[model samples]
Target: MSCTSSSMDIVPDDTFNDFAPLSKRRRVSDCSRSCEDSSCAPLKKFWFPDGDIVLEIQTRLLKVHRRRLQCSVIFSDMLHIPQPFETDQIDGCPSVALVGDALADWEVALAWIYHHDEFLNQVVTFDILSGALRISTKYEIPGLRRWAIEELSSRWPVDVVSMRLNALPHAAEAITLAQECNVPEILPAAFYALSVQKFHASADGGRSHLVLSPNDLRRLIAGREALQDALLRIAVDPLTEPGCANNAACAHCAPRRAEYWRARLAPDPKSPWSTWLVRELDWMLRDDAFAGTLCPACFHGHMSTIKWRLGRLRGAMPGFFLL
Candidate 1:
């Protein structure tokens, strides 16, 4: 049982009845008979001892305590009902069919309930954290859901460029999973990273599979184009020189400096505009290619202008990504 981001799905809203009795509670005899006659005896031995409830999860029987299930409001209400029969009990407790999710998901959820401290201390993997998130969200367990979200969000960098650089292993998956789980805060950076990275075919045959939704796809595409245009405009704008205060310096050096920058910062047809924006901005200000030709006032003024524009660009990044 391998767990990948692709295995994460939106836990159905109706999976757990929060306001009413569980629709799938099976008879104690049926659940107990299956547990006794099947391969679940080993799991029963491990989790069922002194357990008050039998949860038939898929083909397996998971014996869990009612006190542990009470941690979730959904489960608490589901388990609050009186037992139907004392004589039909298995291990001196009732049985219920826990439907919707697979046994693996329940395993993770139950582990979080019974051994929360240990689970939190363990090195959290994507599969485990994702399972916790799905179950927590399904059962309305706020603490577990918050923990899962924090763990997942930690994998993404706050800086957009860093996210773009590290996009390969998780960004696409993060975008898909975040949307599936209804976590909007994680989408902005993930979407920005995907927009800046080179588009590639996924296992689903195209990049379309990674998009959160049609609206999100539209926003990413539009934002990327807008950012490219904005960066190109900033790179090429002749206003970078900011009319030299020293008239003689302006007359002697402005034209050549402007010409040098225009030639140097010209867009590369092969590379993304974001790559050019990130890789060339600092060099454009630092490079001494035209230093020998420009006077002090003009050079300082131009550098200040470029720096100011860069600041503006940085400030506008969140808006560009619809953050």
Candidate 2:
């Protein structure tokens, strides 16, 4: 029976050992048609003598309980399908080959199935969460996928307030991951973060154009230009507040704010991109000297106005990127 999560036909090969060095690992392609090939071996950790099924993944064979495999909806559905007249088997159990699935991801996802406590009690890295999400999504493991998405949502929030407080890591990868997993909620923040960090040459020194797909690159470019225009519009427009106690002071501050943004956004000869206005505004809010220039009432009022405008712009980020 076919039980692959991703696209591709399955081929099983010789011995599998998790502890083996990368250099010594073998591929199923390198083995002969017969199981008698010396290179093929069962993965010691996952191989169970009493297990009912042997999962062939590339060069490794993992014999696990059928019940545990059934936890995944896709696997469960596949298990119910009738077997062909001729079937592959390892030891005494039937073998199911999974093609085009990453062994590392399978390892992590399987760990979650067998050792749930380890993930529950520990802080999982981004790579681990990413792997789990991919595998669970591919395998239709709803519970595991939900847990991974929840963990990611905490880091990459959908709303403005939480987005401001958190710095999203792996911005480029996160964008692709969001699209792949159909997690549109995080796209705005992920795209915004990448735009702020400079897409051409990111803070990590990698070229974003090289990492992002053509469509994503186009969206990023368009969204970044929209952000620049939005910042200019906000800066040039009036910053009046009816509640301002000192209209005179507030009037002067408005021009100063516009000039501040203009100067901050001035094009640099060395770099074509400018800093994101949201980051600049965040810094301005914390600048005591800037705040000191206005009366307390005016300062708070103007700050509120700026925040409201930026918040609105931020909310439109998904559309800005055509997301």
> Highest lDDT among the candidates is held by which one?
2
For candidate 1, write residues 1-323 as lDDT tens digits.
11111111112345343422233322333433435654344364336577776665566666778788788877665555443343233444555544556677777887888777988889877678778887887777888888888876666545443343434445566777877777776665666566656554342214644545667667677767876886566556554434334233387676776676567666555653235454355667777766645678877766776666555655666677665
TM-score of 1: 0.66
- Candidate 2 on 1-323: residue-level lDDT in tens? 23331212222223322111112122343222333442356778787778887666778878799899888876676566565434444565666556566677888888899899986777778788788998888777998999988877777778634555244457778788888887888788778877766445545214677668999989988988898877656546546434434333356566776565567655565663456566666666677776677767667765676566556666687898888
* Per-prediction TM-score to the true structure, in the order listed: 0.66, 0.74
Candidate 2 residues lying further than 4 Å off, grouped into runs, are: 1-39, 82-86, 164-168, 199-205, 234-276, 279-293
- What overall lDDT goes with each candidate model? 0.60, 0.66
Question: Model 2 misses residue 298 by how many Å?
Answer: 2.2
